[model samples]
Target: MGSIDKYIFKTTLASFALVLVSLTGVIWITQALRGIDLMTSQGQTILTFLGITGLVIPALVLIIAPIALMIAISHTLNKLATDSEIIVMNAAGFSPIRLFRPFFLATCVVAALVAFIGAYLAPDGMRRIKQWDAEITADVLTNILQPGRFAQLDQNLTIRIRERLPGGVLGGVFVDDRRDPQERVTIIADHGTVQKTDRGSYLVLYDGNLQRFEVGKRDPALVAFARYAFDMSKFSQGRDVTLGIRERYLWELMWPDEEDKTYQQLSGQFFAELHDRFMAPIYPFAFAALTFAFLGAPRTTRQSRNFSIGGSVFAVFGLRMVGFACSVMAVKTPLAALVQYLMLFGGIGVGVWMIVGGVVVEPPPRLMEAINRNNERIARLFRRPATA
Candidate 1:
């Protein structure tokens, strides 16, 4: 609320925004590339590919928001230290806790955004991605409509055509089915066409010979037919959206459909997901506080705190990894979820205490300082001329 708070708040927020957009954009492009085959190989347009890929941004943002907050807070503090602004503030009788106000506020803001994304935006985006993928998969014929090439429709079906004739006529058609364990089927037809109805789609072959061969006995039995209908249902079966945990909304994770046996079996995953979503928002504040406690406090000397910064990063990263492990462990034991809270809030409390307490939270631990000094000495020794 004060001038100092507002200044730090603006700087932190700006840094976070820049980092968020830049990181999200870089990562999103890599992920979106995975879907490029939809446009290149499949019949999808550029807009369709972009639309489906763009839906992924919300999920990426949820992952990046906390990290951006950490970087932003650290950057602003380091910049202020470099400019001697932090020293001026300390000279002006401002405490570390007072200086932490704006950074804390900024962290809280990012945390809330993460919570919202996890609850609604991320889940909704995931659902959209699923639906889009399913739609693309179900339309198998449309996706694999290339003429004069063999197209593998499913695990055991392959079809090739000499050409696609006008008026939906397929010329020089060859279809093979090997899905059955006991027998293999091959159908050769001079002409064929696909029929899609409300009930299901069918591939009708005219003037074709159907060959069936037993797996153990290879002598084939052949039957000639004027007309035969092959079901396409297997290629385009509808997927049950409820089966996917990421597709389910937050409420569904908390209170799932009771009658579903799969949900009962996967109860641990559901609880884990619920706890993770709720806990993601809390990380920003904890990480921000801890980082500031390590790197934000003022010192009379203008010496670099690179070691302190590295230690802070590793410490925070280790904590984040621990939280990740806790989420996995919580799936098996519900009590593990409590460990996340203890670690997060405990780190927060310690960080704040370091800031407000009169005694110094050393810029770098003595061990870390000693390691750096030793490393520098080794590097200088290695660089010196060996035999002058």
Candidate 2:
């Protein structure tokens, strides 16, 4: 790249980085505040919360990068115009289209990064977050079974533990299992322990008393047991993690059978997403051209630089909102397919018109000089008014 190209690229990138960081900070703060109660209630550690929050950054960048690029490009160009650098380039016969090339390249690089995250990395991260949450929940529930207390796992099962051993063994254990409607089983064990094996988990009791009550029976049978086992496999299955929409890759969404509604949405979303991924890279170029159209007029001492820059920035934001709204609506309707093209080619057309069609009329530098000279003369006349 040439010196001018390098300068423009660096300035635009620095501005884009600042905007991205500011926006991400705001988003993170909002999310953390909203989930603080849930996090505290679940005893989630700070490291786990941070891990989940970190995974969310890529998704935020995918949404925020385009708008950031647009603002950054516009601001960078406006600064150049204010500093008279744009005037020098104009004098050197470098057209606005040529000046926009560097910004366009930068946007392409950012777009590629966004695509990498949106397509693969973000989904994988989301899956990991879900899995981590499920494991934490399982651990919390299992730890709730305390010694010397009547611990109720559910309405159907109640357990009382006299003592707990260092190896997760319980002595003087009593369990009332009411899962079967036809019969209720009561078990008292001198010793028992929670064991996980290939077949699944079990609570094995040694030197236990087993009492079975059968419906319509004359007498309840009580049997003394040397060893008995109660299956605890259900708890593990209850916490089994299932993948959702954010967990699946783009291709998986594209070929959904009948099993996943998330996949169906993914299929629809992918079309719009793909269009956006490619279209977003060119926004910096469009923004650069728009800035040139709005602010590349001859330098005027009378014009307030801040007002001009603010107006250009406002226009950039408005255009971006329109594009985002249109893209969202199009994703669900047939209109999205065409809207992608409209936003892309329409932006390009505007840029081309501003650069090549001579529609953006630069103010005559001589006119500005004349205005300044006339203002000075008017001031001089006012100062001499006492002679009248």
Clashing pairs in 1: none
lDDT, candidates in the order shown: 0.84, 0.70
- For each candidate in turn, give its C-alpha RMSD to the true structure in angstroms: 7.9, 8.9
Clash total of candidate 2: 1
Runs off by more than 4 Å, candidate 2: 138-151, 155-234, 239-246, 254-292, 296-301, 305-311, 357-388
lDDT of 2 by residue, 1-388 (tens): 9988999889888999999899988987787676553344443456666777677777677677777776787678768867888778878988766776787777767777766776787777778878876765564224565667887776888888776554345768899989889999999999887666888778889998899999999788999989888887776554678787557666655555656655555666655655555555555555555665565554544455654466566666766777787668756775765765676567667756766654444346796689889999999988884653
Report the number of the highest-TM-score candidate: 1
User: Which candidate wins on lDDT?
Assistant: 1
Query: Least lDDT summed over 10 consecutive residues: which range in candidate 1?
Result: 358-367
lDDT of 1 by residue, 46-154 (tens): 7788899999999899878888888998899889988889999999998888888888889888998998899988889888888878766666665676777899887
Estimate TM-scores for all models: 0.75, 0.65
